[model samples]
Target: MGLEASNQGFIWVVRRNNNVNGGEEEKNEWLPHEFGKRMEGKGLIIRGWAPQVLILDHEAIGAFVIHCGWNSTLEGVSCGVPMVTWPVFAEQFFNEKLVIEILKIGVSVGAKECNRVVERIVKREDIKEAIRKVMVGEGALEIRNRAKKIKELATMAFEVDGSSYCNMQSLIHELISYNA
Candidate 1:
């Protein structure tokens, strides 16, 4: 509903796991009736695997709605995309803090506790608000600038003489020496 109200083009990736309910039919019951028809050109829902990194790297992408897992957080940072963080479990809340408070590149959707998807629901209005906060108005520009700066630094870290590259080399050398 929030996505619909936001009036933004989105690509949503859905993964199916055996642990979700009992079967495929049951799992799909979560989606609203005629969701695809209603969304039409506004959204694309990709079932199973999607090339997440490739999708994130695309230029048209504005803000990422993320679960605040470490990998997804890093992907969003590297892609230089501001985020709407919705943390659910484990260290996700801490990751959300890092993105929202520490990095200043994200806004939280106020997801606090971990529970069943239905129980921990963030309201559509709140979701829309967070996304709007990150993607609209002058504040959006600032967040995008911060995200761009972070992306620049993240890109530099992978260069030949960059900090990350050097650290990786050192680790490999130490491992080889220890094994020898």
Candidate 2:
């Protein structure tokens, strides 16, 4: 959805799933090359692996399209970027619920049960629909608002005197006492 419309004004840097189509060779070359030839400007940046900090730290990013993996779910939450959830396997479905139902900062892009041996292809239309709801329609604003609030909380939790910081201090103090 984002890439197809990149030339229209949006700029996107997409990390193509390494195991796209469940083990097929990475198609990372095709997207940017194709878009580069098709579009006049630098509108898309597609790669096999993502630059996590580059994406998360960029202020221009408003939303994230994610597979709802545990690490990525937390990354999005910590960054306060609203997400479009698309889970594949393992506990990803549970993570999706946390992002969509519990956090209320992300929206789901429906997926059926995944087969490890089979390749599942999501239609571009479906991708567009989910993105549309998140980027423009429905509860987009609310999702963004919640994400911002969570970002503040995430920042506080990691800063000095915050919950995580205090917990770490307590643990360190206990360990030092034992050594003494």
Candidate 3:
């Protein structure tokens, strides 16, 4: 509902949980009624696992809505895409802080509590607002610039003389010497 209300083109990836399904009849009961029909052209819902990296790297992908997991956060950063953070558990809230506060590359959906999947803690308005902020709000350009700069830095870390490269080399040398 939020994505639709945002009036932005989006691709949503939905995971299939074996435990949640009680045969084909209740397969899509979790979604808003006639969601697919309403979002036909504006939104694409990919079931199961889609190519996340490929989607993020696409030029049309303006912002990422994520759970703020470490890998997803890093992926969003590495891809130079700003995000709408909706953290649920574990280290996710910390990661959201990194993205929203430290990095200034994301907007939070005001998800404070970490609960089970059955609870819908974040409201549609919150999601819409966060997505709007990341996509076209006042700070959107600055956030995007920061995201791109971080991506460049992340990419540079792998260059021959870059910090990460140098560190890797040092580690390899130390290990070789110890083994010798």
Candidate 4:
């Protein structure tokens, strides 16, 4: 239902890192193969892990479809990119809550179970609508601005006298005093 309706004026770019194993691999492999075939040429379907994909950070990537993993969320947030969260397991559900409810950056597809044989799933139309809803709406600009502010704050935190820097210095001094 969702996949079929998801793609319209948007391309679904998919990637999977090698670190995930077990049944997750079985599930992940099937999606890229199946969905990639459908989206090939029309969109992009990348397999394996590549840091260069972060370069998508600069392009006109209107939204991200992610698992709500913390690192992935941070990267997307750093890029000021919105997301369509589909949390698989672990703390991902909490992360999804933050992205959707707290950050107000994106949407969730709800807790829908999908199968391997399911064709025409999460298709072009749905993706197009989701993209439109995220990219063209009223709160998108505000969300983007807030994300940019967080990014700046993160940068500032590492500079001299910043909270993070001062904390590190305090830790070092404590260590030295203990050693003395």
lDDT of 4 by residue, 75-162 (tens): 8876767777777667787898998888788877563433333332445555556555666667767766666676677678879999
Best by lDDT: 3
Query: How high is the lDDT of residue 107 in model 1?
Result: 91
Question: What's the candidate order when arranged by decreasing TM-score?
Answer: 3, 1, 2, 4
Candidate with more favorable, higher lDDT: 1 or 2 = 1
| 1 or 4, greater by lDDT | 1
The C-alpha TM-scores of every prediction are 0.91, 0.76, 0.91, 0.64
Lowest-scoring 10 consecutive residues by lDDT in candidate 2? Answer: 1-10
Residue 130's lDDT within candidate 4 is: 57
lDDT at 146 for candidate 4? 69
Clashes of each: 0, 0, 0, 18
Evaluate model 3: give its TM-score.
0.91
Indicate the TM-score of model 1. 0.91
| Candidate 2 accuracy as lDDT | 0.75
Once fitted onto the true fold, the runs of candidate 3 whose alpha carbons sit more than 4 angstroms away are 19-26, 117-120
Score candidate 4 by TM-score against the native.
Answer: 0.64
Once fitted onto the true fold, the runs of candidate 4 whose alpha carbons sit more than 4 angstroms away are 1-5, 8-41, 112-129, 175-180
TM-score of 2: 0.76
lDDT of 3 by residue, 77-132 (tens): 88999999999988998999999999999999998877665575678898899999
